[model samples]
Target: MKKAFLALMAIACCHFLHAQPTRPNQPATDPANTQAPYLKFPTIPPFHLLKLDSATYLTKDDIKKNRKTIIMYFSPDCEHCKHEIESFLSNFNKFKDIEIVMATYQPFSEMKEFNEHYRIFEHPNIKIGRDEKFFLPPYYNIHNLPYLALYDKKGNLITTFEGTQKVDTLMNAFKEKKK
Candidate 1:
């Protein structure tokens, strides 16, 4: 009887071991279950952000299919962000072919002020918007201000840069995506 009990206990232990949950730090083995926080290069994730108008929303589908996309995350209060925006504005002609989406988590009033100050909305290629719920920073694992994510014409991610970067560097990144 004791032998039978021991055998049952061993079987239970084996079953428990096999049924253990996956490690907390390890990603799931199932392809469907494993979704990275940030979209990898050549992969595009669906996103929805709010426009400064407080009425319209910009989704992945809103992106132009033929134009490469540059998504810039900025804070109105950050000096580096201001510098980056100024650089982009100064070199606006170089990026006329690309679609620029400048998003920020700052209040609508602040965003509007920043947009007016930089005349960002005056450009046909650039769209200044607000992300009120703060969805992007965490989704992209952004650790610094003036983060930039460049995507190909097909909407696939090309590269991501955190902190201030030169306009030429950004242009080159987009150019590299074509190759």
Candidate 2:
């Protein structure tokens, strides 16, 4: 009886050891799930984010034509992010007409605080909004704060910057032809 039980135990162990997990079939890859959605989507994404007021929303339609756009991803408390904004603001004349949309995944209060601290209200051209959908981060593959995506007047991507900002460099890139 003992031998029979030992043999059965050994057989069960062997069977279990050799067994493969029946993994569920993987779903087909969606176009949006590609390596870099932005690479596939070179143009500015159709994003709808909540404005700082938490009342109205900012969307693709809100973007003005004949104006270049800068979609900036930032954290309000981030010093680097603050510096980037300062750089842009100091060179305000160059960026005055550019539509600047600052989106943050941080809480609305922080966004509001940052806006007030920066006196963003003064610049109707610069909009700081809350990304309630959390879209721009993944869309831009943001690994650092203050990621800026510059789009041409035609709503086509020029290039991107991570962790830093140079006003002259941005202006040059914005003038590039789309690939």
Candidate 3:
């Protein structure tokens, strides 16, 4: 009986010793404890989208014509979306060789207002257009806001990033293709 009692005590002590006290230094139990989740744009589908400002529509053929491209979906009323654009605008020169097309599901009036409000005309590489009825989202299987899709010079999908990503990460991703 004494031996069994001592074994129980030892087990209890071990359990107690392993129990961690809640503190700042202690690892968090949240999902954020792991690295942030990243989204890669898919490569299976093709894109055929229309422009909001003009009658011209963008097809896979159109994208195939470019050496490289960046297709992004944004909203005129979205604060996060605007923030993403502002980030791109801040480093517009870095992507001088990359064709960028900004698509919005919102109305043309809103896109126009947003362009005017943000003074997007200053950015030579960004093309603002409407995506309300465009086929880009479905073509690329993108169901999230502020989607940034990168393609190679050969018109192949390189990567598609969802959500707000660090500009440096994106720049590095673009530069990696050169190597």
Candidate 4:
């Protein structure tokens, strides 16, 4: 009887050793998992980018010397980008006092159709520029389309909107100047 009990216990131990665990890396004391906080957009450094029409480029100085600037980082092929720009254009009067700089990571030729189709050039307050090789977007740590950044007349960033902002909200943000 003793021999039989020992033999059964040894077999069970062997079977348990060979079996795969359901949760291999987790400890019993802390079974639940936790995640890290989402990374918000970081403060961006001022830089110059090539414009489409003019031989001269745009830089942080342009924003400082002019009225407040609303930096619209968008993609030419993005429908959200189209909608956002269209909405802004439709209510251009609200932001007329503000300078609108439309920038993209795409090449100039690629953006030609969207630029022409939307007649973005028709708006006097608007300035179209190209990032060429995704330089500005990464510099701003922009991860999504239609990222809107509002900067004061001194080229210091006031606030950044991750996605599209309603006209009212956007206008409100523009009204806020650095103190």
Candidate 5:
């Protein structure tokens, strides 16, 4: 009986010694943990998406070298998404130099209509594409509709925005100094 009691006490002590305080998982992009290979994972992973033209595709390779890039992820039926695009177009002249890649995981037909409605094709600086493989949201751990991943001229990620980002903030991010 004493041996059994000692064994149970040992097990309880082991459990207590091994106990860990639980916490939410930090994003892979968070810099504190260098073990995560995501922060400098060379431009938000290699993505292959279909362009608005439907016949052609837009891959990570197509992104212009030595140019700033904005990867805008949106949905067709989302009101916030519409506002986000409008906000961008309204401030286009200021953002003309920055390359924009608008992407959607929805149907091709819907993206086509949205593109037409916005006359996005007229803006050579912007390219709209379809994320058919549905890779981005999970990669971004996205919880918002209009997510924007902003990269600098050197192809390094400056930061990311989840929802409706102010035009001024966007501009400031464009001008963000290297860290």
Candidate 6:
């Protein structure tokens, strides 16, 4: 009986000693704690991207202005991206007042070919470029192609959409932001 009692006491003491209190200054030791420390919003982050010309670098300051901006992340070989660009071209009149900046992490030659295929440069409001360093994918946590982030005239993020969104849906997001 004494041996059994001593064994139980040892087990209880071992458990108590192994369980440590979490310190206020230290991070959680739990391996299952995977939640982000903070929430991510649609605000534009500072980034340096190369234009299709491969000579000019467009920065965050260069794109900011007193106008709404639509920044799209796409891939040259993505069919969904092609569809989105086609939608924009077909509905160019509706987006005339908005600034459209399309960026891709693909090579300059591929971006040039894609731009030529769509003639995206003809539109004064549109700008297509390459993100050589691939900064946007991780920053935005992109998981799919044709990601769109719409910012208001004051450079505040209005909303973000992933995948192929209808033109009306895109426009309505901006309209709602205005309110």
Which number leads on TM-score?
5
For model 3, how big is the CA root-mean-square deviation?
Answer: 9.8
Per residue, candidate 1 scores C-alpha lDDT tens digits across 1-179 of 99999999999999999788779887777756665467543444566667767799887677777788888899999999999988988888888898888889888889889988988778888887787778888788788989998888887788999999998899889888777
In model 1, which runs have C-alpha deviations exceeding 4 angstroms? 1-36, 40-44
Off by over 4 Å in 3: 1-54, 58-66
Model 3 whole-model lDDT (C-alpha atoms) = 0.71
Off by over 4 Å in 6: 1-42
Cα error, candidate 5, residue 163 (Å): 1.0
Clashing pairs in 6: none
Per-residue error (Å), model 2, residue 138: 1.2
| lDDT of each residue in 17-44, candidate 3, tens digit only | 7785557676666643533222233442
**Each candidate: RMSD:** 4.8, 5.7, 9.8, 8.7, 4.4, 4.3
TM-score of each: 0.78, 0.79, 0.65, 0.68, 0.81, 0.79
Task: Write down the worst ten-residue block by lDDT for model 1.
Answer: 36-45
Better of 2 and 5 by lDDT: 2
Per model, how many backbone clashes are there?
Answer: 0, 0, 2, 0, 0, 0
TM-score of 1: 0.78
Give the lDDT of residue 152 in candidate 5: 86
Q: Is candidate 1 or candidate 6 better by TM-score?
A: 6
lDDT of 5 at 175: 75
- Please list the residue runs of candidate 2 whose C-alpha ends up more than 4 Å from where it truly belongs after superposition: 1-33
Per-residue lDDT tens digits for candidate 6, residues 43-140, read 56676889876788887677647888998999999999999999999998989998888989998899999989999889978888889898878776
lDDT of 2 by residue, 88-114 (tens): 888899998899989998999999999
lDDT of each: 0.83, 0.85, 0.71, 0.72, 0.83, 0.84
Error of 4 at 175 (Å): 2.8
